[model samples]
Target: MCVQLQAKDLLEQPIWRTAELIKQSKRHVAAPDGYVSSFIDFIELHGGEIVTAASSCRVTSGFTDWRHLGQMGVDFGWGNPVTVLPLSTRRLLGSDEPCFFLPHSSVGEGKGDGGFKVLVLLSEAAMPGFKIEIDKFCSQEFGQL
Candidate 1:
């Protein structure tokens, strides 16, 4: 389930207040622990308009945290995964390309002070420009050396 909040509300509120808002949203969506066909019917009828409107928005956020599910620990004899990657967003529910928050491997490149990875999908044409912009930002923040 996804939650939506206004940018103004998020930015204007203090951390504690923002947390409270999140809690409120969660409580508002609380459902019984069982398959509810009514919920699906309700969303199918209403979600189309919301999804269409949100597609044109400047940004949309989604959470894909499954760390609590111990996704990283699963191994089919190949060994633990170094990273989990998300597929393209060609036919996803949300308008904007969804972002994924993945657990970083405790070893290798992901290790060091606390580190996590965010996977975003972008078009092939956008890659070069995005790479340049990211490189520029990294050079500025990490220094020219």
Candidate 2:
């Protein structure tokens, strides 16, 4: 199921309503004229344009959310992963620097924190400014530095 939503609408609606909208918008994938077929047709029709746009765009970063994938609970003999990081050396979705939204570590100091962690791969040159923004956001949101 694919749901398309405008950013303005998403921001204005409460999370529960947004989730309901997404649920209601789901279409059966088994249909002959499903999203996959439409997507394939679209790609066939605009393949050149897509390639051109991808090549021309300078996408530096990408984001993926893996919060509820139960990665923290998987015991691999050595116990669950203390940290999870993407190992893509090459660009993914044209982004060299990727950010992953991960579940907090389930062991040690992070246990029971009830907060998520974001693993961001950024250039050394960009780190200072990024840290400042992150600190500012944390301070504003949590009333602490």
Q: How do the predictions measure up, each by TM-score?
A: 0.59, 0.55
lDDT (Cα, tens digit) per residue for candidate 2, span 27-69: 5455678756876797899867522213444544555678888
What is the Å distance of residue 57 in model 1 from its true position? Answer: 4.7
Candidate 2 Cα RMSD after full superposition onto the native fold (Å): 5.7
RMSD, every candidate, angstroms:
5.2, 5.7
lDDT of predicted model 1:
0.62
lDDT of each structure? 0.62, 0.67
Task: Provide backbone clash counts, one per model.
Answer: 0, 0
Give lDDT tens digits, candidate 1, residues 73-121: 7898998776665555553546455566667766765463445676766
CA error at residue 124 for candidate 2, angstroms: 3.3
Model 1: colliding residue pairs:
none
